[model samples]
Target: MQDITLASAAEIAAAVSSGTVSARTAVSAALDKIARLDPRVNSFTDVVAGRALARAEALDAARGRGEPLGPLAGVPFAAKNLFDVAGLPTRAGARINRERPPSERDATLIARLEAAGAVLVGALNMGEYAYDFTGENVHDGDSHNPHALGHMTGGSSGGSGAALAAGLVPLTLGSDTNGSIRVPSAFCGCFGLKPTYGRLTRAGSFPFVGSLDHLGPMARCVADLALAYDAMQGPDPEDPAASPRPAEPALPGLETGIGGLRIAVAGGYFARGGDADAFAAVAKVARALGADGTVEIPEAARARAAAYLITSAEGATLHLDRLRTRASDFDPAVRDRLIAGAMVPATWVERAQRFRRWYRDAVLRLFESVDVILAPSTPCRAPLAGQKTFVLDGVELPVRANIGVFTQPISFIGLPVAAVPVRIDDGLPLGVQVIAAPWREATALRVARALERDGVAAAPAAILS
Candidate 1:
C-alpha cells in the first residue's frame, strides 16, 4: 500500500475488483495520507475519513458477494468545498457559509461519482466565494502548493489541485468560472478538464457566477481525467444550465491520435502578457503535436474584460442579500469587489452581455478552421506563498488577478480546455491549454493524451520536502 496513493484511479479500481486490494485498504491509505501529509499542504478543509472507510467497507462487501461494481469502484476522491457534500456545511471557502445547515444530499456530481463506486474523502479549501485566482484565503488558512510547499496553489480550486499534486487522491472535482480549474491545474502541475459551458451539471454546488460557472474533474493523468469526466456527463433536470443533449463519453476516443485533426497555437491576445516559461510550455506541446500554424482569436482581450464584468455582476447579484446583511462576514477583498460590482451601471453590464454573444461567434468561426488551439495555462509557475507581486513583461503585476491572464479569454467564450502539464528541467512545471470547440472535450483530451504518451507533458508526483 506504500505506492497506493500514487496509483491511478483505474489501477486502484482494478486491484479492488480482483480482490488483490480491498476497498477498505485503499480508502484507509488515502485517509492515512491525509492525516499524515495534509497539515503541511492544507489541501482539505474537512476530512470525511469515517464516511470514506464506511463506504469502502460497503464496497468490499459488495465485491465479496460477487456483485458488479462501477468503473471507479473503490477509488478515493474529493471535491472542492463549493461542492455540497452531504453531512458537511458547504463552506465554499467563506467564513459565513460555516453557519449554514449541513447539506442533506451530495451534489449531483458527487452522487454520480459515488454511483460509479468512488469513495468521498473530503471537501477541499478554496478562495472565498470562488472569487480568487491566488489560493490564499483569509478565513481558512491558505492552501499551499504541493510541488513547492511555500508557493501558491492557484484558486478557487486551490485545494483540489494541491490535493491531487500531493498524491492525496487521484481524482478531485473543481469549478472553473474564469479559470479556477485550469489555473490550479497549471500551477500545481496536474491535468484538469474544463468542459464547455452547460456540458456538466452545476446543481447543488455553490454559485459564483451563474452564467460563467462550470464544474469538472482534475487528475494526475489524462486517462484518469477522461475517466471521471465520462462518468459525470448527463443532463440534470435540477440544473437549468445543464445541457439537454445526451451524454457523450470521452474515454473511448481519448487514445485516438490527432492525425486528422487540425491543431494550431493561439496567437494575438493569448500570445502576449505571459513570461517565457509560459510560452515555452505551449510551444513544447505544439511541437509534440506537430501544430506549427497559429490561429488568432479575434477580440480575445475584450472578451476577457466582458467575462470579468459578467462574473462580478452575476456574482454580486447572487450574493447581494448576504453582502448587505453580513458585510464584515466576508473576506474584505471579495466583499469589496462584490460591492463595487453591485454598483456597476446596468448599461455597462448590458453591453458586456451583448459583446459576449459576438465574441462566442467569432471563436466558433475559428473552430471551423481548426480542431484545437494551444495556449498557455498560466503566465508562470507557482509564486512563493504570501508573495503578492510578479514581474510580467518587465512590469510588476498583482499575483492574484494576473495568474489567469492566459486562461480567462478562452473560458470567456465557454470553450472546452484541457490543461496538460509540461515539466521543465530543474524548474517547476507549467501547463498548456489544449482547447477545443464547444462540446468537443474528446478532442482536447486526445491532444493531452498524445502529449502524455510522448513524454512532452506530465504531472509528476509533487515532492513535499
Candidate 2:
C-alpha cells in the first residue's frame, strides 16, 4: 500500500488498467495514508473514505466486465475545498461558505476526472476564501509543509501542495488566483500547472477573482501533471470563461525535448526581490536548459499592483452580501482585506484594468522572441510557520503578501505557468516558474520535463517519521 501511494499517478493508472492492481486497493492505500499522515500536516478538511472505496469498487467491477478504461484509470486524487464535491459543502476555504447546502453533483473538473477513471479521494484544505497567500486559515487550521512540518505551505492551494508532497495523493486539483497554485507548489516542492486562464472550466468551483482565478493540476511529477491536464482539456458550455478551442493533448509531445524551443531567463523585476536560494534555483535551471539570455518584461511591478487591485475589488463585490451579513464569521485577515477592497475607488480599478491590458501586451511581446521564460516561483523557500516578516534585498516586508511577488505578474496576464521544484542541498526545495505564451502549456511542461530529466528538479516523497 505504501508503494502504491508512492507511485506516480501515471504509473498507478497504467498498473490498474493492466489489472496489476485493483482500484479499491489503490484508493484504500491513499485513504490509509491520509488517515495516518494528514493529522500532522492538516492538509485535508474532509476525507470521503466511504465514497472513495465505493467509486473504486465500481471501477473494479467495470474492469471485470472488460469495459474500456479511461486514460487515468483507477488513480486516486482530490481537489481544493473550493471545488464542489457532491454531498459535501464547498468550503472555498471559508467557514461562511459552509452554510451553503451540499452540492448535488461534483464540480465540472471533478466529474471530468472521474470520467477519465480517477477516483475522488476527498477535498483538501485551503486559505480562507482563497484570499490568502499563506496557507494559514484562521478557521480550518494551517496546511503544514511536508518537508518541514512547522513551515508554511504557500496558499490558497496549500493543501493541494502538502498532500501531493506528503504522498497522500499523487494528483490534486487547485485554483490559481494571484499565485495560489504556484506559491504552494514552490513551497511544498511539487509540480503545479496553472493552465492559461479559461483553458480549464471553473463552472463548479467557488470564485475568488473570476477574471484571475484559474483551475489546474498539482502532482508529484511532470508526467502526472500532464496526464491529469490532458484528461481535463475541453470547453464546457456551462463556463462562460472556458475557451472554445478544441482539446489539445500535451502528453504525446511532452518528451519531444526542447532542442528547437528558445528559452530565456526573466530579468529586471524578476531578478531581484528574492533571496539567494530563489535566484540560485533559477540560475541552475537556466544553465541546464542552455537558455539564450535574460529578457525583461516591462512594467511587471505595475502589473502585480494591478492584479492586486482587481483581485480585491472583484472579490469584495462577489461577497458583498456575505460581508454585510456575516462579517464576524469571516477570517479576520481575509475580512479586513475584503472590507478595504469594498472602499477602493472605481476609477482606480478602471485604471488598473486599462494598465493590465497594456502590461499583457508587453509580456506577449517578450514571448515573440523567447518561447519560454524561467523565473523564481517564490522569493524564498518555505518560511517558518507563523513567522510574520522577512528581509529581502535588505528590505523587510510582510511574508504573506510578498510570497507571490514573482508569480503575480505572469498570472496577471492569464498566461500558462508550470511551477517545478528545484532540489536544494539542505533546506526546503525551491521552485521555478516555467512560463509560456497564452494557451501554450505544452511549451512550459516540455521545459519542466527537461529539468526533471536532468535531475535538476524533483518532488521527492517526504520522509515521514
Candidate 3:
C-alpha cells in the first residue's frame, strides 16, 4: 500500500471508496505518523486512537457491504482543543478547562465532517482561550512550526497549521476571531479558510469573543479546504449566531477560475507595514491573477483597533466567572489581558461596536466594484518561538498584538477569506488572503484555487528528520 500520510484528503477518500485502500489503512497511517512525529511538533494534545480505529473499521465494513461512501471517505482530521470531542474535555488551551468532564457530544462541525466520512484522530493544541496570536501556550506548550521547529506556528489555530504542514493529517478545524486561522496558515505554510462569521455552526465549541468568533478548516490543498468546508455548511439552531442561509458548496465552482472576477490588491493600510516578504507574497499572487488595480479600505487602522477592543471586552465577558476564581490557573498573559478587559468602559465597547457597523458598511461598498481583494495573511513568516518584538515599517512592535495587522480589518466585519500559502525560495512560507464579500466564500475560494493551479501558491509538506 502507498503511504497514506502523504496523500491528499481527496486522493485518500477516492482510494478508500474504490477499495484500493481500506479506511482502516488510511486512519492507521495517520495515527502512526502522529505517534512517531508529534513529540517534535506537539500538534496533538489528545489522540483518539481507539475511537478513530473503530470509526475507520465501520467505514471499511460499510464499503465492503456496497454502501455508498461519503466525499471524505476515510480522511483523518483533527480539531483545535476548543472544539468538543466526545469523551474528552474541551481544553480551549487553558488549564482550568481541563478539569471539566468529558463532553457527551462532538461539536457540530466535527459531527458534520464525520458524517461525510472523515475520521477524527485527535484534538490539537492552541493558544490559551484563543486570545493569542503567537502559538505559545503556557499550559500545553507551543505548537512549533513544522518548517522550522524553533519558530512559532501562529495561533490559536497553531496546532491545526502544524498538523497539516507536518502531514500528520490532511485537514484540521480551527477558529478565527482575530486571524487565528489565517495567521497559523501563513506561518506554517498551509491553506486555511476563515468562512464569514457565523457561516459555520459554533455549537459545542468553547467560546472566545462570541461576536467575532469563526470556525473553519485548514488543509494542504485548496480542494481539501473546500471539501471540508462543504461538508460542514448549513444552519444549526443550537448556535444562535449561525446563519439561516442554505449551504452553498464551493467545491463545484472551485475550478471555475477567476476570469470574470475583479481582483485588486489592498493599498493604504495593507500596502505598508511588515517585512518585504509579506508584500512580495501578495504581489506574487496579484501578478499571477493579473491583478493590477489597488483599492484602499478607509479607516482600516481604526478598524483594527475596534476589533481589538471588541475582542477584549467580549472575551472577558465570556470568561468573567472563571476570571474571578481560577486566575492563577490561567496563562498569566491571557489572564492579564482578560483582567484588563474587565475594566474597559462599557461606553468604549459601545463605541467600538458602532465603529464596527460603520466599517463593515464601508468595506462592503468596495466589494461592489471588486469581486475579490488580496492582502497579506500575516505581517511576516514564522518568528522564533518566544521572540518578543519585530520591526514593522521600521517601528518595533510587540509580535503578538501586531501579527494579524492585515487580517484583522478584513475579519473585523466577518468577510470570508481563503489564506493561500506562497513558498518563497527555501525560506519559511508566507500567506496571501483572498477576500470576498460576506456570504461569498466560493468567490474567495475560486481565486485561491486559481493561484494554486498557477504554481503561485502551495503548501508543500515540511521535511522532518
lDDT of 1 by residue, 35-110 (tens): 9999999999999988999999999999999998899989999999999989999999999999999999999999
Alpha-carbon lDDT of model 2: 0.92
Tens-digit lDDT track for model 2 on 18-73?
A: 89999999999889989998999999999999999999999999999999789888
Best by lDDT: 3
What's model 1's TM-score? 0.99
Backbone clashes (count) for model 3: 0
> Where is model 1 poorest over a 10-residue stretch in terms of lDDT?
456-465
For each candidate, what is the lDDT? 0.91, 0.92, 0.93
- Displacement of residue 266 (Cα, Å) in model 1 is 0.5
User: Residue 446 lDDT in model 2?
Assistant: 91
- Model 2, position 63: C-alpha lDDT score: 92
Could you give candidate 3's per-residue lDDT for residues 198-304 as a string of tens digits? 89999999999888899999999999999999999999999999999999999999999888889999999999887899999998888899995999999999999
